[model samples]
Target: MPSFLQVAVLLAVVITAAKGAGALSKRLGQPAVFGELLAGILLGPTLLDVLHWPVFTDPPYLERLTRDLAELGVIFLMFLAGLETDLEEMRKVGAAAFFGAVGGVALPFLAGTALGLAFGFPLYESIFIGTILTATSVSITAQTLLELGRLRSREGTTILGSAVIDDVMGIVILSVVVALHQAGLAGAGDAAGGAAAVAAGSSGSTAAAQGADAGGAGALAVGLIVLRMVAFFAAAIAAGRWLLPPILRRAARWPGTEPQFAMALVAGLLLAVAAEELGGVAAITGSYMAGVMLTLVPDVKRAVEERLAVLAYGFFVPIFFVNIGLETDLLDAVAASGPAFLVLILLAAALGKIVGSGSGVRPFGFTWMEALRVGIGMVSRGEVALIVAGIGLQEGVISQAVFSVMVVMTLFTTLITPILLRWSFGRAPGSPSGAAAFSPAPGPRSGEAD
Candidate 1:
């Protein structure tokens, strides 16, 4: 591990770059996060390759620390977002958000799968591509909206709501594909060994038995994943509705520095851990839920809002954005894939969210431009796509080429969403319905789970 001295230097560099770049970006009329993210890319292999510097080289110790810290940033941002969310306002746009998310998820999945197959990839691989495309990391969007002071707008609420739904759908879809991939491997292995068993003359049933076992296992996994998802939602909502309020209410009376506020932060962290370890969902999901649940209590919301905003926006959240750029390698993969290939995959990933989500919300109360903004906001697949791509690579369900393309797509989408959102929201007309719901600048994807 790096010494504290070294760690301090690393932290200083990351924070300085993030804040400095953010300021520059704001001056350029873009979101500060855009600059923070761009700064990360500049610090990474795309330019300086900072991690390879002598200071950070201990078999990824600093690298891991950076990721963990970035992840914490993501959690903080999402938690604050939850605090700012107006439940009643979200409810007003619930159907539109739901339908929009459904469309956002469905169309990209189909398009990605078809594109994979068109290139002659295998069945499971094709499905995995579709699944990868289904992710909609809303972290960038949430931050951008916060920057623009639009977090309380109708479009903002709807986008936030749709992201939650989008993540659940994406996670569930990934689970199904993972099961199928595992089962396919199991069946293939069994079949390969079947001839040997047949030669032994005592095991005509070997292949059948193993196939049955594999099928059962696959189905069991998918079932458990779905069950866990359902259980998490139920428990989170129930506890938020009942359990948390009293605990927080009591905490509010304590002499500690914003005791109830501290408790709320703890609850968010605990739920974030649970979301990953038990709920079979992203950690951000839990944190965001914690924020949402805490919002029901006026005291906790007031306290947390006062305390968390500075910590999140001032420090951690910028790291979260910067770390995204730090982790990316935008050129190598794109250069290898050729222009036509890049354009095809990029278009498939981008349009899926834009066309699907946009149309989904348009049928409700949104204007065409507003719907377009919603679609643009959902385009960045963020960190979740990287997770899915990593899994596919580990399972041998996608080639390095495919994985690289995903990385490139993720980079493009992440870099573009903030800019697109600013453009789209800028053109959108202001109104009282959305304006009245405005709360403090809370920040989001179900994000870095984004």
Candidate 2:
């Protein structure tokens, strides 16, 4: 465990650097997140290692503490995002959102898989790499749009809705890919055991029986995973509709906002834990669902959002963005993967999202410029990408070098997304028409940026 003093000092440095960098970024007309990310890189191995700094190098405990805090940051950030989402807006753009999400996921996945294969990676590795490319982090884009005062516009809502759908699709794909990989491993083990038993002429029947059992188990596991996911969403939605609103309403009457905030936070955390523990879904997804559930309660949504934003944006969220940079070693990653590989992967990531998502929204009556704006908005892959990459690294599916390359790719995409989105919005035909055009029946805090 890290001592209190060590943790405190580490946080102090992190917060100071993050805020300073963020301020600098704002001065440069960029989102504060960019500066925070850059601050993390400067304080991390990329720069600190050269300077022999101990902030990230000499203390394992500090690193762990930072990671834990960062995870909390992401949970709160996602929860806030969910709270801010306009379900009515999403409904209006449902067709466009669905197609955009599908195209965004499919094209990137296929392109990434093909690239991985071209690089001579194993089948599983290739698939995992492809999976990484499917994630879309819209928070950055949302912030940029908010800065440009276009977040409530039609294109903005479309991007937000599509990004939400994109996340759902990405999680489902990840679950399926992971399950399939496990099944493959089990089959390989069974095959090896069966082969060995047959060579020794020692009870091939037992090996065959075990292989059958293993196969059955794998199938059962996959089935259960799918079922769990369905059950989790069903339960969350049901609770949101029937249980949570009343509870929040009651909590809203409790003298001050603290009670309501506490109730919301507890509910969000509980659902998040349950989602991961019982449903085997990502905790962020659970938290996001919880936020969405609360959004249905028009009376208390703004209070909850206002209360939570102070804690989230003030501290935890910045840490999450910065932590992404701290964990990545850009130079080492590029050196190991080769500049060509990095450049190719980066290009693939960017174009796959822009073209795929852009093409998906064209049939929805959006002009080419509007579709391009939506596509550009979905190009930033932040927390979700990092989480997926981290899982892959932990499971030994992707090497450290690949993980580093992914980190750099994520950072690059995140940094450039705001600039690209701003440009796209500028070139987009027509002025910002506010939220009324997209969602006439605004849910609680619906038009706020994620």
Candidate 3:
């Protein structure tokens, strides 16, 4: 464990670096998140290990603490995202968003699977790789659109709605894959046990019973995951419609904003925990739903958002972004996977989303150019990709080389999304010359519609 002094020093260094990098990135006309991510890479083993920093040389408990806090930051960030989503606007683009999300998910998944198989990976690993490609992290895209004053535009609304649906689909796919993998393992174990029993000349009943039990358990696990997901959303909607609003309204009337803010935070945290523990869904999803619930009371929604934004953006959110960078060792990853493989992986990640999601919105009457913008917007994979990759790594479903490639791909996509989004949106209809038309400005804060 790290001493108090070490922990304090780490926080100070991380915060300072994140803030300084963010400021520089903004000054350079890029998103602040880019700078924060880079700052982490510089301070982490990727660069700082060369200097033999104590923090890098001897792993400290502070690193774990920081990781946990960073997770909280993600939860808060997603909560804010949910709060900012305009339901009314989402309703307008519902059909387009649904189709876009489906197209986005299906195409990338198929491409990723085919690529992984072509690279000689096993069927399961290939499927997981494809699963990783299916997520769409739109925080970067949303920020870019907000900056361009297009977040409230038709395309923007569809992008945001589709991104949410994309996340849900990704989570479902992840659960299914994990459950199936577990079942496969159980079947293998049963086969091994049966072979041993036959060699020993023992009755096979015991092994058969064990196999039956294992099979049943695997099936039950999958069923529970699905049930929990349904229950969570159903409960969240019910609470939002009936229970939460009165409590929030009553809390809003209390002296000062503390009571209301405290209520919102507590509710969010509780829901997030429940989602993970009971619902088997990502905690960020729960927090997001909580934010959506809170939005039901419009009068206090802005107040809650304003106060929470300070806590989130001022500290936690930046740490989350930086922590993503710290987890990666890019040089080693490239060495292990080979440059050619890495390039292929990156291309698959980028092009899969573009083609999948872009094709999805075409039927919604989007111009080809507009569909392209939506596709590009969906290309940036952020925390969701990282979380899924981490799970795969922990479960030994993905190799270290694959994990590293995913981290690199996630960062690369995030960095280029804003530029691509800007370029795509800058091309106005009927403009003769395709010169850049949009001037980037600090738009509405992250998560808010323009």
* Candidate No. with top TM-score: 2
- Tens-digit lDDT string for candidate 3 (319-433): 7767766776778888987898788878888888888888999987899998998889899887668767766775678887787788888778877888889898884455333
Error of 1 at 332 (Å): 2.1
Q: Clashes in model 2: which pairs?
A: none
Per-candidate TM-score against the hidden true structure = 0.78, 0.86, 0.86
Lowest-scoring 10 consecutive residues by lDDT in candidate 3? Answer: 441-450
On lDDT, the leading prediction is 2
lDDT digits (tens) for residues 213-295 of candidate 1: 76676567667777887899899999999999999889878986778878888999999899878887767778878987877
Of models 1 and 3, which has the larger lDDT? Answer: 3
Q: How many residue pairs clash in all the candidates, one count each?
A: 1, 0, 0
In model 2, which regions exceed 4 Å deviation? 49-58, 146-154, 182-201, 253-257, 425-450
Ranking by TM-score: 2, 3, 1
Against the reference, the lDDT scores of all candidates come to 0.76, 0.78, 0.77
